[model samples]
Target: MSVAGVGGFGLGRPRARRTAERASRKVARNVGVPLLSIVLLLAVWQGIVVFFHVAPYIAPRPRAAILAVTQNWSTLWPLVLGTIRETVYGFVIGAALGLSLGVIMAKVPVLQRLVYPVLVLSQAVPIIALAAPLVLILGFSVTPKVVIVAWIVFFPVTVNVLDGLSHVDQDLLNLARVYGAPRWRTFLQIEIPATATPLFSGLKIGATYAVTGAIIGELAASDGSSLALYQEHANSNLNTAAVYGTTMLMTAIGISWFLLVVGAEVYATPWQRRTVARRTWRRAGGESDG
Candidate 1:
């Protein structure tokens, strides 16, 4: 091969190696740091329990919490499944309604004027305060829990969607209008895509809140088989380890649900991801060249 070919091969190999190194570093940053932090946290927790001679009922050690989960897995698994179902149902119903309302309000000035204040006022009333009334009216059933979750999710989704819609570039919109693009066509093509990021931001926030809403709803109602119910039982019985384990499970569920939303967002907006990756690569390449 010519000297040019040899030089090209040398450069290509280095670039490939750099790319692999970057990818590995990214993975380590994402996964390794979190794992290390958790291990450190557990160590500190165990140390505190041992050093303080803390009673198990007041503050169970990390091992005790893990034991609680393992020992009660048969009972806990059903409760976890129940809570997951409630969270999904609530998130779907809430997201749909919020998106619809946000779109309608954004498109119609009259609707915005009439409805925005009501929406703001609705959020002013604490969801926990309404829990008892909802239980009384809807009874201690899944319906009430679903409604509570929907209520918690609706505000964030609506507000983010409205913010997204409002921020659409006026120049782009005017250009579309000047080009004789139909309002609906322009909105479908331009407005929706432009707003996708903010809308998903809202959805992610709602997803995080969904499980908490379900838990709160369950706690408000007396009879139910959910993590919240299990927690309440554990608290009453002074099974602190079980209470901690239930909490950990709920937190894991919430994180999983949030990540699912993020995955959906990434899938739905491939262009956005590509754009981000390009910018990141450019920045990295520029730094290296410098």
Candidate 2:
């Protein structure tokens, strides 16, 4: 009934329309930016190849790579699935065992001393060098692939977690002692939380290693069902395009696995999420104030 009420009603429609337009613009930017960037990259690549007269054998054009993927879809599907299955199984098993070992090594000084050096030395050994023996010992079955992947994934996670445990704030430890907290309680409450970032860092690295290890295992074990065998055939036939396509597929798989682990890290660390939210809110508040 008031003048203000009348004015609010009159302005509300325009405000709503403006809000919708802003939101649509934001969505368009989000979608369009990535698409435009990819288009530009492909265009540049194509132009370079055209100017240089790059042979397909040396580097397939983006169109050829795409065509190879589409054409080989049926042939590559099973091999892709097999590689994924092995990588996943290995990641889970390796993470489980490695996390347990890390916990033990960190909590007990004697065990830490005994195991840490061995873990370090094992990492120093060339992974590829061990591939043949692994195949010989475990055969071309899934066992060797899983073992190799686990071995590759284990060391990084173990080292990161152990370092995290070691660096848990002594002040926090003393505070826990003052509160009459048990050793395990202190570890769960203070140590593990403090070490979570490093642990996740290791996990992310290990996830990529898991994929690489699985590929290596496939190469060495030479089972007919694996992506390595697909590569072997492609290499033999000199279908360099297909080989490049398969490599791209492997790269995509690794990237996807890394992103999955990153998602897990972001989900597990609420402090990180809240920190980001606060920074965004502060930035918005500053802009509003300005």
The lDDT leader among the candidates is 1
Name every residue pair that clashes in candidate 2. none
Candidate 1 lDDT over 1-290, as tens digits, reads 35556555544432222366877998899879988998998999999999999999999999889899999899989888989988999999999999988899999989999999999998899889989999999998899999989988888888998889999999999999999999999999999889899899999999999999999898897485778878988999999999898888998899999989988997787776353444533454465552
> Candidate 1: which pairs clash?
none
lDDT measured at residue 229 in model 1 versus the true structure, 0 to 100: 75
State candidate 2's TM-score.
Answer: 0.81
Query: How many pairs of residues collide in each model?
Result: 0, 0
lDDT of 2 by residue, 1-290 (tens): 35656655554432222366876898689668867987898899889988999988877888898789789899889888888888988898888777888889988999999988898888888888988898888888888888888898888888888888888889889999999999888888888889889888888989988888989999889757789878878888888888888887897788789879988987778677442344533454465552
Write down the worst ten-residue block by lDDT for model 2.
Answer: 9-18
